[model samples]
Target: MTAPSPARVVAARVLERVVSEGAYADLALDGELDRRGLSARDVALATELVYGTLRWQRYLDWILAPHSRRRLDDLDLGPLVLLRMTAYQIAFLERVPAFAAVNDAVTLAGRARKPGVAGFVNAVLRSFSRRGATEREPRPPADLVEALALRCSFPTWLAARWMARYGASEAEALMRALNERPPLALRANTLRVTRDALAARLATEDDIATLPSRYAAEGLVANHGGSPSAWRAFADGAFAIQDEASMLVAQLLDVRPGDTVGDVCAAPGTKTTHLAQLLDNRGRILAFDPQPARLNLVREAAKRLGVTIVETLDGPAEALAPKFPALCDAVLVDAPCSSLGVLRRNPEVKWRRTLEDIVTNAERQHAIVTAAALMVKPGGRLVYATCSLEPEENEDVARRFLGAHPDFALDPPSEFPVALDADGFLRCRPHQHGTDGFTACRLVRCRR
Candidate 1:
């Protein structure tokens, strides 16, 4: 028999790491790809299999559970992962022939030293294929939470939360949208080139197709082709890869040249650099993060993008609040969150996170926002943002902060690409806006 595809083998290994070791899928995939030295096409294939399998894991499990004589959870990790990978290809990935998918999975099982498991895998996959599995849609469980969870490949608790907040129809739509692959969006660095100018240059030099983002003025959606980072425009600091919804946060902050801004959690510097670009690289930005290594990433990105105004401060955000009380013209509390909004890009999040994480994140967010509040000048602006769809993390925290700090009132952003709630907070949903789910509430500190 022909050897199993190297891409499938790599994908299975990555999934095993993600499932058994709790490793982040992207990092694990990157490490494996680098070590394996796969071709570009193979790399893309492996990436799709890894992400797609994870994205539809719940659905795959639902189908496999009924087929396996042994409990799926009780099976060895290697065999179980192989089964899921094969099921994904059989049920969803039409480009992969069913026979090849089944044969590859059986081959992988034997290679794992479980020759007995190979027969079991062949039987299960052949059963699926013989029954015309591609045409069969599993019936939804009677319970709404369970049904939506299985149907959309989300955790029951998460599905329940969305249903409670958005009603069943909208929640299903949101979950369906989240299962899709997000377009790669790049923000043009106006300091180096305009959006139109960069798009022109990319077409001429890289042959990468491009389209303007509906909301973010500088945002461009790469239509097709290789990674933009490999292109010369990226090397020249022409743009930063960022979601359109995230781009809105810096825009709402409205930093002007010479403004003193504070980024409370500015690691990896996506927004920090955007702030510099908006300021024309002439303002002072005190970027703070708890981790020194992550802060180093911000510094490197700033150097690459030709931004020189940001000063890195390596310490917890809360500690800095006391030292520079009211020192910033604007402060961004981009608090760590449960990350429910960016699920399309990070599918593992749906499986890894729990309902209790929402509460935990909210508690941490409350403290961070409270501390960051101290850095904004009395008459200056403060924006609290998160890539989360949860009300507790978004609106409730904003409300609680307003209640405690009477000096700060919701300012309600006037100009943004996404829709605003009645309270004037910026809210973008994956289904509605085709962007990562994000919420930002702008507040103006009352003058003493």
Candidate 2:
């Protein structure tokens, strides 16, 4: 029996973590890659395998279901994931030959399971390989939403909701856009380097090609390189890897130097550090999140970027709101959301999320925003934001906040109105903005 490719082995192992253990794909893949020490070529292959399999999981299952004797979901996790991994390569990854993919899957299955399991995998794949693309491909359902869901590998319920909200054509465009890889967006740590200077260094020194983001002054989109963390500029805190839309969210706070800011629900402190940068590292930033481990990421980023203004807080925003009532010049509630807006970055989310998760997060978002509202000084801006395309968590949450507290009103004047929807709430869609599907509404507390 031929040996399986180590890259395939690693990809399958990480896929198991993501599927069975609920590990984050990006973090898990990074950890495995560092431990395995795969070459750049195989590393890229493994990375592609991990993400692409997750991205097209629904569609790959559709392809495999008819070929399998047992239900795909009922199958053992190991064989189930290996089958999806192999099927993804055979169908979508053109560079990998079908025979090589099938052989590797068979080898992997044999190593993990009884003899019958290996035979089962080989028979299923050989039959799958012979059937070819068009033969195995299902006819698009008569319902446009169903067709879109199956075609784009989305949950039917999610596709249905999106189609109803965005209409069929635009929803399909959004799905297609999210299925592809997003650009590597980096925020130039203006505390240290100007955007232009950093771009020049990335090219001249690091040999990484780059382009300035059209939306954010401080944002640079790196084309291709090894991870940004490996770059000397990143090590020196010259830039922070943040989405262009997320960069815009922090900028919306418009906090000036020496002003106090509150980052309610802040963790993994990407925006916390951005607020500090915008504040010229002179003002105080009260950052809060429930988990210490996630807060550690914020602290590490702050230290790396030379940001000294951030002050981390413990407990939920509502519990801590009493400590600083009307204390900040600006407050940012980067609310915990379903993260439907960032599917390209976290493709596993499409599988993991349920409709109830959407509803529960929306309710939690409203409570957090209301609590954060109390901490904003009168006339100060309370920026409510989420990486969620869902209205219940986005506009509805903002609107509900306004209903209970008439003292707070929506503020429409923004640096990036192009991302604003017809109703004036900021809506960044992957198809339209080439960024995550972020929705932000800026609310200003009345002076009286």
Candidate 3:
């Protein structure tokens, strides 16, 4: 028998990996795309299948439950994922033919080596597709928060959490924004090329267009889809693929050309390189993270971005206190987070996470930032930041850090470049700012 269509097979496999093996969707998809060598168009389809299925998983399950005899969770991982990915195509991807999606899924199901599963997949998909155009779809429950969560493919608790804080109208706007594909945001590597110059070159040289970001001078929004890492410019360190909001986090530091900076949790060094860009690659940036393997990623990023000043420290934040006491002019604690704010970019996160995870992460984040606080020189600043919309990880951690450390006071919001909330924390929301959700606050160490 001929093999199943490459894109569909890849998409199904990726969904299974994410669902069963707990693989990161982006990394797993990238590994498949790189190895399979599918056409650019097919690669796009496979990407859409994986992300769309993952993004709308809760809603897709709701749609599929009525048709299948077994509970979705009761089904084996392979067939269940196949149904979800196929249903996503039928429900969302207009360009894809529903019949073809069904056929491809049956083929993948057969390969799962499970008896009768292919028949089960075929029956369910065809039944759903035939009725989908006419069916009203399962009505969202009468409760507004649950209804919104069902429609938006979010967990009910998260929806309620947002509604309580942001009000119903705005909470929905944020949820809808998180469901759509996020724009490709890139930061111009000022160490190598100016933003305007890079934009001009990408357009003229590669036919890829970009728009300058309003909030970040070095930030550019790519008009093209897909990562530009393969482009010659990427190799030359002309840009770093990063969110506009992320680029602005480094701006909160207000670093000069020469300053000692500490970057806590600086894995993959996206911000460390940005800090170097701010420093004109002129001064020292001691980049710290717990994992040595991840720290190597930081070094590689710094090298590729032409950020020579960033020195990688291979250990946890706690180590920094004893080794570099009061050494940094300004220290940035880009603390680990629940990452709820980046749902649009990382849809798999929503499915894998629970509300309890947020509170648990908050505890760890507070500890790391407190350790990072020790490395800051008196009169210098300690900036705590996270890619999370949740208050526990963002606001609470920052407040607790200040309460515990008597020497530091909250920096005035006006000192930073971005628009901050009433409390002076930089809250960049996807709906409001057209950027990833980020909360960052600066605290100044009082001089003796």
Residues 83-154 of candidate 3 have per-residue lDDT tens digits of 999899899988888988888889888887888999999999878998755582787689999898988889
The parts of candidate 2 lying over 4 Å away from their true place are 414-419
Candidate 1 lDDT over 105-165, as tens digits, reads 9999998785588999888778777656555556667887898889899988888888988
TM-score of structure candidate 1: 0.97
| Of 1 and 3, the candidate ranking higher by lDDT | 1
CA deviation > 4 Å runs, candidate 3: 1-3, 132-136, 413-417
- What TM-score would each prediction reach against the true structure? 0.97, 0.97, 0.97
Residue 65 miss distance in model 3 (angstroms): 1.7
**What tens-digit string does per-residue lDDT give for candidate 2 at 1-448?**
7778889999999999997899999999999999998887788889899999999998988888888899998999999998999999989888899999999999989888586888889888988888867788767788887788998999999999989988999989999988989899999999999999999999988899999997988999997677778899999999999998999898888889999999987889899999999998998999999887888888888999999989998779989887999999999999999998999999999998999998999899988998998899998998899998898888888888899999999887754635576787887889988998888878899998
**Candidate lDDT (C-alpha), each:** 0.90, 0.89, 0.87
Which residue pairs come into collision in candidate 2? none
